[model samples]
Target: MSEGSAVHQWLCWGALYLLAARVALSSETRRPCPQSCHCNSVLQEVNCSDGQLTTVPNSLPQNTKLLNLTHNKMKTLVHWQFQSLPQLLDLDLSDNIMALIEVEAFLGLERLITLRLARNHLKIIPVGVFAGLPELKLLDISSNEILVFLDFTFRDLTALQFFKAADNDLVFISHQAFTGLTSLQELHLDGCNLTAVPTEALTQLSGLRSLHFHQLGLATLQNYSFRQLEHLKELVITSWRWLETLSGNSLFGLNLTSLTIRHCNLRAVPYIPLHHLVYLVYLDLSFNPITDIHRNLLGELLRLQELHLVGGSLLRIEIGAFKGLAHFKLLNVSRNLLTTLEVGAFHSVDTLKTLGLDNNPLACDCRLLWAVPRRLYLDFRGNPPTCTTSDQLQGRYFLDFTESELPGLLTCRQPRILNRRPREVRVDQGHTVGVYCVAEGDPLPSVTWISPQLKPLSSIGRIRALSNGSLEVRYAQPQDSGAYLCVASNAAGNDSLPVSLHVRAFPLSSEKHFRLKGWFAFPSASPGLSGKQNIPFDVKTLMVAATIGFLSFFSSVSVCFIFMFFWSKSRGQIKHTATIAYVPRSAVSSSNGGKGNYMETSRFTMKLI
Candidate 1:
């Protein structure tokens, strides 16, 4: 993957080189070559990149100002090619099959600003290769197969702003290679296969602002490689896999806004906070094979907004791991095999808005939710909610469940209030007696009832629940002999037990005694065929029964009146004199958590005394 990405990077750089060459060559004038070479005088510039020319084109018309011949079949720079063109301002001969250059190759042109000689098949460049281009601002001679270079290769450039000499087989870059440039802004010398760069190789640019020295294929970097860059805004330095020690001295005075280190094989990152870079926003330390990242190692970056921690092979996430950060917006710890997110791992991220958990084979078991407890309201835009049963999260993208979807798996239990429901049997005329114990459920269960006398009753009375979980006959007649049933239900199903009742024939003993007394004691009365004595009334039994029933009726009337008066006094409360024990706190416990916390409005308590 790394090699393929590098090849793609080279392709992009090749396109950029073509564009720069085309834009800079627009201000130049071109004419016909002296030797039967073709010329396009329509456009002012002459571009001959990747051609089969042998020597420099000493064409006619000295008014030519630009000449680009990158990647051509040329071997040496002839003296006659330099003697002809004195008005040239830009010259490019990059990626050519050139082997050597004569001392008198570039004798005259002193007004050049941009020069490119990259990707050539040269072993060495002579001392005075660019000694005449005094006004050069940008120079790129990268990707050459040069093993060693001369000292005075670039001695006259005083207005240089950017320089790149990367991907060369350069084993050494002399200290006097950049002696005259004082205004360098961005410099890159990466992938040069260098072992060491002398401190004086880059110490001359007094106003250098940005430096890059990545992929040098070195096992170590000289500690003084960045000794002179005091105004740098970005820095990236990476070595081979064996480079384990990144000393604190290597980052002595730089307070760069962006810093990246790859393939360092780091074991730890010590407390080295860059002081003056208040704008430092990004830090990436990838591909290191690190085992741990200590808490708050980058704690001093008050404005660091994003952190990417990929390919580190991290194994543990400790508590306070992200404490004291004020502006870290997005964090990606993806592509790792972390088995657990330890306790308090993100306990102090007050401002973090996004967290990535992709490419990790995290367990989606019941216990994993105990670690995070609940999902926060933060933006979980791209994070996938994992499922236990399938690899494809079952097409549930960012889906979340409320209390209904999770019961014991979410630390929730159904209310036991429904368990103690009294049996209710509703009796209608044509409908069979149905006794169902309807209970609110975390999961609802089916219920049923039973009755006998398969024929339907025409005059069914209003059903009332029996206190003993059974139904009783409010009024019974000879035809009312039957069985009634009450059922209790559960999640599996419901079952009921039958209750039997028998109606026996009642005797008429009172009528027989009254008839005997009337026949024996009294003859036919003259007034109205009365042949019996007058029967005496049972006044004692009747008076006692009447007195008891009257007292009960009076007591019920007084209670009803009192309740009605108080019900009108209350605003939103309905008072009832319950026959069960009522400690108000226990009643309120059903509303709060299991903690039994209660809250009362500061209104008058119209509670029943």
Candidate 2:
């Protein structure tokens, strides 16, 4: 065997031998109990609680495994206080007046695993007070007057797994206060004076799995509040009355499996943050002011199994509000303002096991028929749902009716036309008209209009069937003048109302005479005669015709002028002017190199015919 392998084998055997020796020594060792304490030999326990002792008791058995000295008046824990009890595994000093614990107080306790200092008057924990406890796994200092945690306060407790510091007047925690707690998994910081999360301090505990925050003065959970807590699996935040907004990315890097947020002043669900928790299994959002669940808000939570939204002001659940939740099992929405539960709100309820709908004023109607058939498979917690409305079924249990009676109990009201009397409507040709009819029913009625020509009028073109059971006809003509029928129908029954419409036609013979007079009327007609009485000619029509005739004559004259001007100019003769030039004799002599400077004058004239 190699040298390294030999040494490992030797160490394993040595650890086994040492464990056996310690057990043998503990079973054989025995000592007399102190006057103020009780000892159990078989269990190796020492209980000195409620003794009111001012100091640690002497004569403790060396093999004691559990030591409890709670409810005492011990003011200090000095060095080597538990040096004699090497095998002690648990020590509880709760309900004491201990104000100080000197360094090296637990120096020799190498195997100690649990220590509780709850309900004490301790305001400060000295550094290195828990340095030698390498195997310590749980430490609780709750219900104290501790105001702050200094840096490296718990650096030596490398194996600590759970730490509780609740119910303290803690104002601050240094960034490196929990620097060496690598194995810490659970932490509770309830009822503190912190205004925000101490993200830097908590990031040192890389293995943390659960965290709780309660009764804080925070108004908002800001973005990236728990950014780097990658292994955290459960989070609880409650009793924050001032909390209003939970930002969209507050839980950015966490993979929490369970989340609870209750007893806050939130007016709406924080859907932006919740959509990121695709692996979430349980969620509780109870006791808020939320009134409705909108569609697609919880659709991304595919693995969600239980949802609790109780004791809120919830009034409605919109259609497909729980879409994409395939594995959902339980939904508790009791004590709300919901009057009816519609089956179309959920994507699928095949996997639902328990449902809570008690304490709501649900009206017993056909809307609840879908849940009645699934009652055999669903478990209704608390009180069974009872009807508070419907004159015949009020104060009756939902499940009391038999399958045969359900058909009669869950019936819809037939559609009834509010206006049943035939009416007459007169409209001028080329004008618009509307025929009116209204309906009332359990389920709203759909309106259809049949025209005078026996054709259904759709809401597409000139003729339209309006939303409120009214028919509108645009540019009414003679063909549109007849009796029109408006039909309103639903699943229960149908109703119809007739309306007589008359479209006034123009006077054709008078119109022809008026046109002929407008074109051939003589200007010698009497000036005092009224156009409508004598001439049947309109002054506005005459002015319009005169304006058109003037514009046409002006346009023709302008075109003829432009063409004649261009033609005359093209046929005219061209003329050019003559040019004459005189050059000096000195200039000619310069051109001749000054040889002939005497009297040389030149004149030239050019012209074109």
Candidate 3:
């Protein structure tokens, strides 16, 4: 052989010789227990850790209450080897290859209370494996390769307190698998292959306090999956991709304290009542496909503290959805597809503290901050959104925008429409008053108002323009009570259809005399508040007549004075000319007060002759 091969051979021989010597020494001392299983007579305990022991030793100390046979190559529990240890209280067969357990494997250990079979290759639990252990309190069968569960797997274990079957390949669990486990406090069935758990499956566990059945690779959950487990405190029945049967009323009678249902395929999370679960404080339904939200669904969960809806595809939220959740503290809706929420969506959750909505296609409106209008613990670290019109949201923190402002703070789309023009009309309620109606026409029409008596109220109303400047009308008292007809003439002089109207007198207080039943009193401009009126003037007319008489008397005197002055001037011309003085008719009239202010004077021109 080569030098390297020769050296490796020597090393292998030396190791085997040392191992044989140790086993021989242990056998010579009358201890059939393997050399790896250390023994202590004082404590009466044996620890066989990390070995290839074929079976547990039968000659162990009668006082041994604790035996740890961990990490061994034991294929099956040997009754003859372990039946003599009557005081054994803890037996740990974890990390072993005990694939097919015989029914009487644990036959003689009547004092066994705690058994650990974790990390084993157990396919199915035999009914006799736990047949005689009446006082067993905790049994851990987690991380096993269990595929099928026969009925009555735990039927006779009446005192079973804690059972753990986590991380197993359990596919089909018979209804009787947990038949008589009444005292079971906590049961874990996480990471199994359950597609749809029947409601009656958990109905048998009367004293169960908490149950976790998560990540069961489920697609559908029936209504009866959690039918009768009234004493359950915390439940995690969510995260089945096809689990969609749970509406707001699924878990009706249970008094659960905390519940989780995350990472499921529900497009909408219906509101489920939690009144019976008065002590429920923690609730998680995150990562579901929930999109619809019914109003006032969370009101009954008065004591719920934590709620998770992470990774859900929830889109729309309604008003008053969280109407009276007084004790809620933490809420998680991370990685969801929620696009919109009303401004008052969660206002009624009076004490909610923490909320998470990160990594979602948040409609990214400036108003997302409304999700936490008050000071709150929000975990929207990084979510994607695009509002190309805005500069404030350019790569900054989404909460920087949501928190800096409010929910729905994002910009909304707007549109523009045309404005309508106002119209005017003229009304004359006199004998010729008229009413008219009109529509678009090639030529103007001659519309008129008529009384029911067949007499035309006003000829002008026949051509009055409408309020829209497209019609005209006249009116009489009685015909005005009904709609007036308007005829539109076409380019060919053909009359067009008349637009119909249900017209009556404009309601006025003055028209209360025309009151009809059921209608309000006619609206009227307050009387004396809308017009200009005149008063009687006979006394003023008489005063004017008296003043005119006084003025005329003065007028006649003044005229005579002027004429006398002229005659005197003529005399001064020494009889050269005949002087004439005359009194006009107005002077006589003025003396009898015929007019206004007049002059009165005497002629005193110097006559030298």
lDDT of candidates 1 onward, in order: 0.61, 0.86, 0.64
Write down the TM-score of every candidate.
0.54, 0.67, 0.55
lDDT of 2: 0.86
> lDDT tens digits, residues 1-609, model 3?
999999999999999999999999766754454476788777767898886777776566666888999998889865444777788889899998878778777777778899999998988887766777888899999999898677888876788899999888887888777788888989988788866674555777888888888677655554446767878887876556666656545677678878877667766554544545667788777766677567777777788777777666766566677667766666666665665444566744446556565555444453444554443344333342333324545444443554345433554432211122222333434234323344342222234333334354443444344444244443423233343333433222433232333334443454223223444454434333323132223445656977897789889998989998788887664553444455566676777685655644333344333
- Weakest lDDT window of 10 consecutive positions for candidate 2: 526-535
After TM-score superposition, the amount by which residue 210's alpha carbon in candidate 2 deviates from its true location, in angstroms, is 0.8
| lDDT tens per residue, model 1, 435-463 | 32444332232233344644322224543
Candidate rank order under TM-score? 2, 3, 1
For each of the candidates, the C-alpha root-mean-square deviation to the true structure, in angstroms, is 33.4, 16.2, 33.5
How much lDDT does candidate 3 score?
0.64
Can you list the residue pairs that collide in candidate 2? Answer: none
What is candidate 2's CA lDDT for residue 62? 92
- Kindly list the per-residue Cα lDDT of model 2 for residues 466-533, writing each as its tens digit: 87778898988767788888888755678888889998875546543444445554664534322342
- Count of backbone clashes for each model? 6, 0, 56
TM-score of candidate 1 relative to the true fold: 0.54
Q: Model 3 off-target regions past 4 Å? A: 1-33, 38-45, 58-65, 145-148, 167-176, 190-201, 215-218, 247-249, 272-279, 292-294, 338-343, 361-390, 398-609
| Ordering by lDDT | 2, 3, 1
